[model samples]
Target: MEYIILVITFTLFIIIAKDLAHHKKKNPVLK
Candidate 1:
């Protein structure tokens, strides 16, 4: 159970990071 939770959290973190990077590329003014 603990291992499953860890994998979920890690996946969410990577997804969020990619989203932020994409937004930055789309809108340089925001950065």
Candidate 2:
């Protein structure tokens, strides 16, 4: 069960990271 939760959390983290990266790319001011 804990492993499943960990995997879910990791995927969520990756999704969030990708979203943030996309946002940064869209708005150069963030850099």
- Clash-forming residue pairs, model 1: none
Q: Give the 10-residue window scoring lowest on summed lDDT in candidate 1.
A: 22-31
> In each prediction, how many residue pairs overlap at the backbone (N, C-alpha, C within less than 3 A)?
0, 0
TM-score for each of the candidates: 0.85, 0.86
Off by over 4 Å in 2: none
Off by over 4 Å in 1: none
- Distance from true position, residue 21, model 1, in Å? 0.1
Best by the lDDT measure: 1
lDDT of each: 0.97, 0.96
Candidate 2: tens digits of C-alpha lDDT, residues 1-31: 6999999999999999999999999998986
lDDT of 1 at 4: 96
TM-score of structure candidate 2: 0.86
